[model samples]
Target: MKRLVFLLSALTAMSANAQGSKKIKEKDMPAFTQFTYTGNDRIYNDNPLKEGEFYTPVLQGCYPDPSITRKGNDYYLVNSSFAMVPGVPIFHSTDLVNWKQIGHVLDRPSQLKVEESRISGGIYAPDIKYNPNNDTFYMITTQIAGNMGNIVVKTQDPAKGWSDPVKLQFDGIDPSLFFDTDGKAYLVHNDAPPAGTEQYSGHRVIKMWDYDVKNDRVVPGSDRIIVNGGTDITQKPIWIEGPHLYKKDGRYYLMCAEGGTGDWHSEVIFVSDKPTGPFVPASNNPILTQRYFVKDRANKIDWTGHADLVDTPDGKYYAVFLGVRPNEKLRVNTGRETFMLPVDWSGQFPVFENGLVPLKAKIKMPKGATNQTGKNGFMPNGNFKFTDNFSDAKLDYRWIGMRNWRENFVVKGKNSVRINPLEANIKAKSPISGLFYRQQHATFTAETTLQYLPKSEKDLAGIVCYQSETFNYVLGLTKKGKDYYMVLERTEKGASKVIASEKINPGKSVKLKVAAQGDAYTFSYTADNSAYKNLGGTVSGDILSTDVAGGFTGSLIGLYATSGNDIQP
Candidate 1:
């Protein structure tokens, strides 16, 4: 099996490089730069990315609450695409570490409306920001359901499209975008100002408004409050939320992400002399933390904070934030990656030399990064192998769906992708013709290859492992009334059962397949392509985890369809 996965990835990179933090060695990993083939996506390189090192989820799976912004030598970043529908993802670094997904910011579905919203409820934390004297880029988000709160979108070319959402009446969740130093433009958020009153479970507050980019909105009365309760309102530090806004040397800092995000997530600081803030509280205040390394086994990296900070057009300072790594017993099925380091601003403030634990899976690259064309990082690039194989005609921009918006019902066949199964299934209410992409390796497998021929029983289709709409796992391909099975199904918490089945007969095609490794998921199938069959149990990738499918995205394996339910007993 590929030399037992290369001697079990070189004995787990020689037992994590004999216990120190900077290692990456499965033969200098990065999937060996090119020898062809990188199937189960191995490049978990335990550290070895040398010479000024580098390699850290520069942007890995479930990229959560990140929000970086740069514009000139290029930087971008923008995660937190809640109900997923091209909500807000956009990456494009020039080497503040490597990154490259370059597109997404509500890529239209009327620009801000997640078809009924559910799985972690629609786009919640976005920030982007780039107003080079009005060249414009702004993002600011939080739309748990249509335009009920913060929203603002723009683009001078967010990779070629964007601009439609502008509902910034603000109530808040995690919206940001600050441009002050004479250009004036603020938003910063966390919410609770419709005449204040929240004072408990992280009792909200860190506000600001005044936007109005030539009538784009948010400045009618100018809104207020810029720091309340976070940073010592007597340590009420609960869910103080991700609220970025920086500007050093001229002051006006204010970074957030307090206790609520798991294991008491952190990163807290404030400092104002203007940008509105009688703000102050940064004697290194939480400044950044691994929540006390939870148990500190040399820094365990528990749910660390939601940071932002950026600067590198020959400037240096870098941040990015959001962490999580637990694979088996500590359990986290990937759900929050994106972690970059560097930022010691000579200690006048910003720091991260182990900024209070967990930031060393190898880091360094940032003192005038030459923008390595090493083909957008985390390996497999030089030789390629992330796989799609439905034969492409356009759909390879990292597919996504679930809040529907795959360019008018997804059709692109000649090689395959004719999915028309739209009676809405996955147990309806929101699920529809899914078509995901983002399981970004912890070990991979994901298969597809169905041909379809069921006239009823809602003509289902196959292959999923998704993580929302009540957690998922499905295996699909049904017809019940005419007997054509291959189901497997799961769905936790919100409930749904069926574990295993097999009875197929549509022999023109059928591949299926699953196979994650750390949280388990196994399933298998095959018919026209020969030899495979092995479906039944082992589905617990923590029920599409976020602590059992609660959602912030990550775990969207792929391909789905459904029609079966018009009544035919």
Candidate 2:
């Protein structure tokens, strides 16, 4: 609808700049300028794209543990940003169907300390590697918050930045970084099968270490466990985490991720001569899966695997993993994404082309490339539309921020962007003045255009559909006693309610939207940019879903602000 009438004329100019003549007080904040998202998903408009073709999760929403690396015709790709805040999210491609995000490998803040974790505790499954021996480019991961276990970072230029985060004595959770040809340097991970060697509940274990890479650490005792309970530990395999290690041709491959990322996830393989393994299983072991299919199939795509593997420069081979796409009641509010295929490695165990069945949102472009998704900036799949206009003060790596990225409450004007509210409010686990974005489709529609004037109800300033800090939904503009309302709260496990409120009519300019279709969701607002009104009538997105808000991440939307306002209208 003309982008909803240019998002209601930028919220009627932020409600006429909040009734000019200054004097709004009461902790007045909210400035926002423009924001708009749109994603008509009927399984991406019932699948279209027939030029050379392109589309696969290829990164859609809530990007998950992808990890890829090439560096010749340039490939690079990464995902897994657990506590958000500019954490890992690099991208760039040559023809992997046109990618390009180019930023964030723990951008600053002393290499991301996750200001307070939660929201699925910080980082997890990262793994990006490239080392023509020393041209450098490594990014290992696993920081379930605090103690920041297993880290690593480097960059002989992945786009000109990186380095800081070198803590890896090990303990485990998806580390990786192989590099051998003659120079040697291993370090695979996913541990916990040593002390007592418990054999049941999701028994993990894939160890390996020797690394040192000129003192990046991990050699003290040279650990070794390498695939102990995964592919047929006699049918007890489970959560054998995201471990990668490949060598191919001289033999040595390990690959992992066995059931336990939901719906029995997979991607298995093994074979070794020695990177640090006696390895073997791979009689076609999973090779990538959709768990025996049949969960109501059709436009489905369930949790696939946690892969990583690359090779093009004419060598072929491709993999990248992570998957998800539930909606229409199957639940999973867009988390775990990034998907890719192609890899037949000509026998000796390497498969995935068509990855064992049922996953195809069109593909078939890779011959000479050319799709440049949503044009130059890449990142845009199927039905899409985005608009920011925060007019650059640097911000757009898909606008993140959660456990940290404070940058003094944002500001950046000339076009608009103002936030400054923070008394810690999106249900504080800490750090939140808002500015998120990653609800990338499954029926979408966001919107924003603030310029507030709250002054009470502890103050609040619009839009947020967040999915953590205890499931979310807040739609703003506060001030309760002397008038001016809007409200619409929701939260779910941390408890909250107020599902509706009205009393508007103050100095106008507000536009806040939110729409969905999968699990329903509605909420609306508008102050004269023409009709909208509907606060809380269709709710139930099943608590923004991670199959009921349990979280690994997804569903962001934000642009919020707060003074600690506690929902009440």
Candidate 3:
């Protein structure tokens, strides 16, 4: 009876603490809603046979290259923010599946280069870990624009404060920290060897060296090769990267993502007796991949792998990784998003049964987590209806801007959202006058019916698979003399490629639908939902990386209006 009373008191205190905060103002909210859906939610519910079922993207919209760590009962994750002013966005969760963005690690201009760096190249992967001895949380990141190998920062109280970033002399892309039981710290990195030398090691190799905690440097005498790419190479030209380490029982486990991070790549697990020695591959290599699941719709898109593992308070293990769902017809946008899976341990080794399987079914929330539902909801699952009458007092989290925004693009009146052409063309200097959200699930579809009023030859309006100004897939109506032309442009390759062009009459409203099943994408036009035809050309490869785009967010599916002259939609 005494223990029960104490438990009740504790709960009461937590409730009070949670209620202390007030709702953030509409303008003060983060630039992008972390997990807004760009497609139909039915795609994630299409698969019902997978074990443990499947959930929607927990952290969406440019929430790629995830690095997760657990400290006691709390779990923390940080993702690469790239050119966004605040470099790395940090999220915390009690349950491994549900996450909330708490703060950004680098909030100062000195830590991030937003003015000069392209949107997609500012920040790379970041690894988060807690140092128990010092009682501090440490974050390591790579500044692609600065061309610096890695940078480290720490905070004693993650909720309130963080230290300035300290540069480290390490030549690698994705850098992770492994704290051994003996209190020794080691740095594991994907070594990018000198170019054009066959003897030089590939990115797949995991190299380890003792790190000096006080000086924040790699110790000279502690360098050693831990895992080699030759043993677990993916069937792609790009080598493996993103190495994360964990130790269980008497064995050290190295789990890294393989494949070129495209359609054929995936995650692989290896084990060894020591931290710096030859590691043996698990019986089931590519332990977590969609390659073997031929019939799964989620596998249809290129499911390249990059993963981070974390354990729950109850001692259960989980892995968070990145995957993509491509649309062949509208193939310009290809930013990877986050996905979660449960990990089962057998004896000393960890196993993931549902390897590379897409989330096509509803999943029950873990014990103690809340499940909230709405059209543009806060929960991990659920679809957002992009169709807005613009009746609300303010824009919903479902909408994100394509570039640095201005007040001229949207005018919210009493009944609907009026989108005006801010620029002359889709590829113009002015902002793309539209609201967008990321493509969340692997097999969903997006449909938008738009009416275009082109004011000039440069005037156009329609839906786009947006990454950056250079990397996007656009299908819009452009004014040509007295008529309108339906045009398809592929910008993923940096240079725009006009894939398809057709003439049509202006002022007619047309319905556009973009469908995605795995890596396969199809774009269709219809006056009605029942009839459709395919557009040509498909986008794939590193061109899909966030490094190519300028947005701090992911690929967005939104309406855009542009013109050299004045036009409104």
Q: Runs in model 3 with CA error above 4 Å?
A: 1-38, 44-56, 60-62, 114-120, 194-204, 230-238, 293-304, 326-334, 356-370, 373-379, 385-436, 441-464, 473-554, 558-569
lDDT of 3 by residue, 410-470 (tens): 5443443445554334444323455665666545577666655554566666667666656
Model 1 misses residue 477 by how many Å?
A: 3.3
lDDT tens per residue, model 2, 1-569: 66664554445334423422122332255787889899998866777887888888878889998888887888889888988888988988887888889898888878888778888889988888889988899998987887778889897988988988988877868888799999989888888798887778878888888898998998889887877788888799888988888887888888888888888898888888977779988786888888888988878888899888888888888888988888867888988889888887887888888888889877787788778788878888888899987777466889888886645466555568766666678877867778888987878888877778777888788898888988898889888888889888898988888878888874747888899988898989888787787887998888888988886887888888777788888
State each model's C-alpha RMSD to the native.
21.1, 20.3, 10.9
Scored by lDDT, the top model is: 2
Query: What are the per-residue Cα lDDT tens digits for candidate 1 across 1-569?
Result: 66664564455444433322123322211110101112243343433455776666665577788888887888788888777777777877666666677668777667767777886788877888888887888887778786557777787877888877778665667878787868878777887634556666657778788776788777878888877768886766677778887887788788888888877788988777788778887876787777665453532456778888887776668888888766645556667878877887765678766868656666767665643534543222211246555564456566787777665345444355555555666655564766777775556666666766665575666777777766777787777776788878777765777777778785766777788776777888887777878788676788777776665666777677655432222
* Best model number under TM-score: 3
**C-alpha lDDT of residue 195 in model 2:** 80
lDDT of each: 0.68, 0.82, 0.61
Error of 1 at 210 (Å): 9.3
Clashing pairs in 2: 15-509, 352-355
